[model samples]
Target: MVSSTAQPPATKRLAGRTALVTGGSRGIGRAIAERLGREGARVGVHFGGDATAAKDTATAIEAAGGTAFTVQARLGKAGDAEGLWSAFDAQADGLDILVNNAGVNGGQVRPAEVTPEAFDHLFAVNTKAPFFITQQGLSRLRDGGRIINVSSGLTRGGAAPDLLAYAMTKGAIDVFTMTLAKELGARAITVNAVAPGVVDTDMNADWLRASAEAQAGVSAASPLGRVGVPDDIAGVAAFLASEDSRWVTGQWIDATGGALF
Candidate 1:
């Protein structure tokens, strides 16, 4: 149901748009931040760790003649999400795009083995934070603005037994995006999700380091020979943020390089 012809001029398409990308210090989030900045939008990079990485991302944006700032926040903590908005808003003023890209795989624990604390924390970051964060961003996001929730292809592709909890969280992301898009549709704010396959991010790189077998297994199982890269997801994210996808909403686009198929 996306109207591809609804595109606007590139120069003014996302100009003046301010975006907040959570867990944006590295990986897919970093790619999204850089891409949006290149498109003439003010960028807010949110990080849970590696302050240096966050600063580096912000610096890269500035170096490219774009405005940007960084904020550190732990989505696992209660009230931390509210604080994140305060800092992000102070830096960028208002938001036009919000990318919920901060997530984890529950540290390779199976759902049956996951403790209450572990499972709760995963949902807090992957599902809870985006829900409340987007709620907070509503006042700031302009009508016809964008929201891109980062999910995982594992929900449909089936996760390794150890990744069940992580897949569960991503499932919530899809439902959250669909329901919220309907709720916000009246205002023209388009809500959608992008589910990525195994991407060559710092996150996956760590997992690859921990278990090369697992990494090799994923690559071999994929329809594409290799894993995905950050730019792969970033390009799709940029389209969601731009006027090119103004009429798109309430759905999840799989950016898994056909891994699920």
Candidate 2:
């Protein structure tokens, strides 16, 4: 009954799958959306503002023989999650993956100087929005699905006194990912967090922007000897999105350049 050379069928991993990525207009989120498309998943690109950026992301996917649509919403707001999912609903029936990537620095440069208002804002986006969005996603995500939350290594290491508020938000994300993984495991859905090290994105380009010295300083400290690129994080996210990680959950994978706290 077993045929050695018999091909069972043509299996397309994500050929008919659908994924929604928040803050996909640019930076790490953009790269994630694009990578999912390359893997044959129809992408729902979520952007806060900058319609042009979202459009460009979608267009690039379409041009590269992939499927994608744009969904815009502010990640830190209450009603935005629903609206974002509503847009994704138009393109597909059920969601296969949800990538929570939208986050802010909380405007706190130092821990002692952080205000309650600024700190709260960081939780809203970095933690709260992702929590609520993941809740809503349960209704849309298939029984067997994937959820990836973005976090930062700052949460594990010592606080940047100034970046304290932002770091706290990431800590909340760590807990969220762990707890949700247990809750959703029975449903066959996996949840995990990807914590990144210092990335040379426009989000952090100010001090390190085009400055070789700044880059060198950061690079010299990390074991990898280089700052992060979008693709570096994207690769891990792509793995989490695929069946390759079907048995993995409730764990935080650090994409940091071997930078220890």
Best by TM-score: 2
RMSD of 1: 5.1
Cα error, candidate 1, residue 170 (Å) = 0.8
Put down candidate 2 lDDT per residue, 103-191, tens digits, no spaces. Answer: 88855376667777877778888888998888888999998899999999887766778887788888989999999999999999999
Runs of candidate 2 exceeding 4 Å displacement: 1-12
Clashing pairs in 2: 109-162, 110-161, 110-162, 111-161, 111-162
Q: What is the C-alpha local distance difference test score of each model?
A: 0.83, 0.84
TM-score of 2: 0.92
Q: Write the per-residue lDDT of candidate 1 for residues 1-261, one digit (tens) a residue.
A: 111123222353567888889988898899889888878888899998789999999999888777788988888789877889888767766778899998877677766789999989988888898888888879888888899999889888888898888899999998998999999999899999999887876766666647767667767756766667788888899999988898899889989888777
Measured over all alpha carbons after superposition, the RMSD of each candidate to the real structure, in angstroms, is 5.1, 7.2
